[model samples]
Target: MKKQSIKKTPAKTPVHGSKPALARQVRIIGGEWKRTPLAVLDSEGLRPTPDRVRETVFNWLGHLLDGNWHGVHCLDLFAGTGALGFEAASRGAAQVTMIEHNTPAVRQLEATKTKLNADQVQIQRSDASTWLAKTGAGTARFNLIFLDPPYHQNWLGKVVPLCQGLLADGGLLYVESEFALTDSADSVLPEWMTGWQVLRADKAGMVFYHLLKRQ
Candidate 1:
């Protein structure tokens, strides 16, 4: 008896020639861009701030500024997905400068800016530390600054001090970290963080987020 021959199925090739993984998206939680979804790239250590956390942060800021964003200038030092920066721009920030070192992330930011017709938003591809150092003091000042650098890098220690000079008087600094900058008696405030006073703080899962002001 002849053994039955096994048939091999041909592998199916993707129609799009190796399509990249579908980008994850996060939405703008408030302002004119409310509920607008922006694509998020899967870069190493890139964690977009959570929606609930962002809502709480913006709420705190709104209360502090009495819901006025007309003259606000915002700096997003580590703009992973432009979530924070775009949100500020949507809320009527006069200018929003988003710094992202990742090439893909920067391109995505530009695309989103164009899609939104965001003339007030500027995207810069540069290392956050390098940008901070080169920008220096008094050259530019922002009413709000978002610092959500990659975790475990001690980025807060490096850039927090520089932010002081770049921040306008009465400006607010928003930070997201793996560890709490405040509320830990065991944690000594780093010299760079000493000048900042935590205005509002809360934890969401592994993230410790805070809104601070210069002392």
Candidate 2:
């Protein structure tokens, strides 16, 4: 009798229309929502600022503001997971407007806002660039602006200049980029970065986070 042959089954692949999994959760490291966890969506290029980085950044801000977040108006250009914006709100920022173009991400932001009962938070569903362009200078100015757009898209070049007009004098701008903004021979500062001074900067893995103030 001939031996029977067996067939092997191929591994199952993710269905095309299935929803993406929740990537992970990041907690508010300080303020009213301290230790509160926010859900992060598994979207391409979505990088939530790590907890350690945020703690350092906020420490820098706290020192600058003398530990006062009152009356601070913040704009999160690429609000991704609402980590930065919400953090600002948690710290008592007067207002926090979060810009997110992705639908699911926007939904999550709304849900988080509702959960926190954060009346100071505002969720806007629009592309950051378009929103900035439509928002006239002097009409709105934030004491702190968070610019953590997706990396390597020249988003800094496009939005940094616009942020100049939206940033109040003596305000702070927190940025996360793929590379350090430097004037060294190997790495030169982009033209848009002119007129800004890097007050504090540190690196975590491949992230080059900086806190800047306009000259």
Candidate that would win on lDDT: 2
Give the alpha carbon lDDT tens digit for every residue of 23-115 in model 2.
599999999999999998889878999999999999999999998899899999999999999999999999999999999999999999999
- Please give the TM-score that candidate 1 achieves against the real structure: 0.88
Best by TM-score: 2
What tens digits encode model 1's per-residue C-alpha lDDT throughout 82-131?
Answer: 99999999999999999999999888999999999999999999999888
What's the lDDT for residue 120 in model 2? 95
- At residue 208, give the lDDT of candidate 1: 92
Question: Where is model 1 more than 4 Å wrong at Cα?
Answer: 1-22
Give the residue spans of candidate 2 off by over 4 A. Answer: 1-23
TM-scores for all candidates: the values are 0.88, 0.89
